[model samples]
Target: MQYAQLGRTGATVSRLVLGTMNFGPHTSEEDSFAIMDRALEQGVTFVDTANVYGGKDHRGRTEEIVGRWLARTGKRDEIVLATKVFGEMGPGKNDRGLSALNIRRAVDASLRRLQTDHIDLYQMHHVDRSAPWEEIWQAMDLLVAQGKISYVGSSNFAGWHIAQANETASRRGSLRLVSEQSLYNLLSRSIELEVLPAAEHYGLGVIPWSPLSGGKLGGRREDGVRRRAADRRHDPADLTEQLERWETFCEERDLTPGQAALAWLLHRPGVLGPIIGPRTMEQLDSAIEAVDIVLSEEDLAALDEIFPGPGGPAPEAYAW
Candidate 1:
């Protein structure tokens, strides 16, 4: 459990963040508690969750499960608990988005469900295009002043959105986004086109979510093909060919595809860490292996050749 600064902030966090998205829907509460216990035992102090996580019908169940774990273990101060906003957690018009009202209402609800007085990191689950930055920052500022949250972050945001957010926060003399949670994996490198660059420029730690591409790179080659097929983004035949090449490379290096994939993210520049939402204790233990698995120059180059990202950052990615 190597530790590093969370972006430019003075605070430190573990390289392997424990994500609790699967706590309620896929995993039983007992298993969830056990998994978290194991992670904490192994020094995974950074735990992430969201208020809207528990499957469609049970939006707050995941947080409730986490709250119970915190209460039962009495480790609230030991863990850096993070969660998200900007999701529909209710049926009202003011239930979602980054409006001041929603952000205020959302944080209180999250605190209750998480059973924590303050969120270590509160993130915007998605970009709320309609919400003005002034309004959003105002709400966030209030929380900070009230001691409801320590830091703010963003997830699933475009490169431009990252720029927009920080620029606004800067104007308000606020400590802008300290970290970014984006979809980045061997199968999806779209963020490399701009998001990574923006985060680096703004000094936000890059935390890659779904680092396995929803199990595509988790030694389960078929998941990649099946998921891609549903979106019709790539021909199934081409995707299979790619996955076979990837598997062969992993085998030659005596690595599970999961290990190699995680190691790749660990090696990426500006990446603080990748989020690991393990459904079982074994999965959590397996992910921990990559934290120590060093990928050399050759290994990284080979991975890039196998899963070439969006060319590079734009406008170079698109032009000269």
Candidate 2:
């Protein structure tokens, strides 16, 4: 697999990151282990997980499963492990958020669950409006000094949130965020408005999650099929048309819809890689194939015509 520098950091990661959100709840431990083994075999060194994965009752279960795989194969040093915080992990209100106390407790809990001494990337699952940047950065700086986490990242943060957080870090002369993870896919291009530009300007790698739009772009759903039941909600006719065009585009190139979607993200500016959350070994193998499917300029233009983004970043997309 091709590798790229994660933002301005010295570390290089695989072009495709393996996501473990389905572990325990949707996939069994044996299958999760097999999928992870296949990922490493296919040269995927980046694996991402969150503390609140595996459903409410099974929170931290996915990390435990991953930890077992790491122990069984003794490949802890071979992978760049990433995990997130800022979810309700306990019965109390203090169990979540970016408060220094919660961060301290959460990191230790995540480390224990993952069976690792240090996390390669520790990401905030979402922005904590109540917690100031000072508290957040101070906790993160302590973690860095203690060798607990090498780099910091954010997930589901807006453009201004990234700017504010990084500006705080810059003023403190501490390590700034090296990456931003957001929901970006062929059907969902909202991040193209401001988030992508902010990440690019700040030298942060953009790791896109939900790159397939929850199986809508995975080629399993029939073209022109309504996403929701008519009784539940009205499906947009334009979305169905877009999906039809997307399917035709993929078929013309002899590529699966999922593969084309991933290739699209890989070619987008400021994108380090797209997170692929595969439940089975077959899905894992299919996602890895996207690394080799390069799209030409004409193909990219066709895709733009199918699912247009915000036109371009920010005011240029709107004004002068």
Candidate 3:
């Protein structure tokens, strides 16, 4: 796998990041371990997980699983470990958000669960509109000072909000976001209008989630769509209706919907990497193959012609 620098951070990461959202709950533990092992063997050294994934009851099972695997494998120094915070952990009101107190509490919990002292990249899962940027950055700064987190990032944040946070960090000389994790796929292009440009402008590495459009682009039935009608994981109500036009466009281009979709995003200039979560080794193999497939200018033009803006008749926010 090709490696690139993670934004302005000195650390380098593989072009593909192995996401563990399905590790604990949806996927069996055995399958998770096999996937982890295969990814490492295949040279994918960047592994990302969140605190909320592992188990329905225990939480942090995904990280714990990684910790155990790393311990047994004795390859802790071989991979770049990245994880997130800000999702609600339990019933308590303070169990979530990016406030200083909650950030402190959350980092300690994450460290214990991951079986590691320093996180390579610690990210805010989403913007906490309730908290000031100062509060969030201060908490992140403390983690850096304590050697708990090496670098910080943001996810699910708007361009304006990220700009504000960058400004705050620049003035205060705190650790700024070195990267961003957000949804970007063939079927979803909303980030291109705002987030992508912002990341490019600020020199932030853009780690796009759902490069396959959550399996929809891969010509698979999106299971998440069946689970939640309004699920952004697969079919956003407005965007799904637009899929007909998109699929037709892909067909005319002589490309499978999945290939066409991933190719378009991969060709975009600022994209640093894509997070692809495949349940089976076969699915994983197919997605990794996308790295080798190149799209022509005509193919890209054809896709751009399908939905030039926010996609279909949907408002931009309807996607995320």
Candidate 4:
């Protein structure tokens, strides 16, 4: 577990961040605890979750499970905790977006649920178009001033949106987002065309989610099950062409699709870190092994030929 700076904020985080999307729904509390323990034991000091991952219909279940683990292990200080907001959490419209009111409300709820007073890296789950950039950045800045969160970031945002927010923060002289999280993988290299360059140019760290392209790279699809629908890969509509190209590339590289996929991103320059969402120790090990499976120039060329960048039609809005 190598460590890297969290953008320009001077905070260091583990190279591999443990994502807890399964903590609430498909995974049980005991399983969640075991996963967290194993990740920590393996030196993964960065954990990412969200207020919406808890139980079905009951938001914040994942945080509750993490809170219990923290209390039991007394390891809150040992990890760099990251979580997100902006998904629909309830019936009311107020439950969503980056509005100052909701940011305040959500942070308090997140703190209570996670059993922590301050978050390490707070993030906007997605770019909420309804709110102006200043309003959102100002609200996050307030949280920083109040000592509720150490740093701030964004997820599923376009390069332009992040630039706008950072410019807004500059004008206000507040803390701007230091990191940007988006989807990146062998099958989904679209970010390389814009988002990645923007992050590098602005000195913003890049932490991509689903580096495995859901389960497609993992090599364990059940019979009759869709390769992506079950695991939420790039929008099904946009994946056909990319997945086909990936399948061909895997054969030529003599790499399990997963290894090739992860290895490609592991070596991409300017990536602060890539979030690995493994459900078990085996899956986790495979992900870690990818860090060392260096790809040759030829291998990369093959991939570039398949998932060519912004020149092609854009992937769907829901691909994230």
Instruction: Name the candidate, 2 or 3, with the larger lDDT value.
Output: 2
lDDT of 2 by residue, 1-320 (tens): 99999999999999999999989998999999999998998899999999999888979999999999998999999999999999999998899999999999999999999998999999999999999999999999999999999999999999999999999999999889999999998778999999999999999999999888777677644575534322212244546767777878888889998889999999999999999999888888889999999999999998888888889999799897
- Residue 37 displacement (Å), model 2: 0.5
What's the residue-level lDDT of 123 in candidate 2?
A: 99
| Steric clashes per prediction | 0, 0, 2, 2
Cα displacement (angstroms), candidate 2, residue 298, comes to 0.4
Report the candidate with higher lDDT, 1 versus 2.
2
Residue-level lDDT tens digits of model 4 in 1-320: 67888898777888888898887687778988898898898788999999888666878888898989998999999999999999778888799889999999999999999999999999999988889987888899899999999988899988888889888888998768889999987667778766887787778889988877767665535484436546654566776666766776776667777767767776778787788876676777766666667788887777777766454323333353
Model 3 lDDT at residue 181: 91
Over 1-320, each residue of candidate 1 has an lDDT whose tens digit, in order, gives 79999999998999999999999999999999999999999999999999899999999999999999999999999988899999998999999999999999999999999888999999999999899999999999999999999999999999999999999999999999999999888888989989999999999999999887776666654454333324333445567778888888988989988888888998888999999999999899999988888888998888889888878898898898
The lDDT of model 3 is 0.79
- Candidate 1, pairs of clashing residues: none
Residue pairs clashing in model 2 are none
| Best of the candidates, lDDT | 2
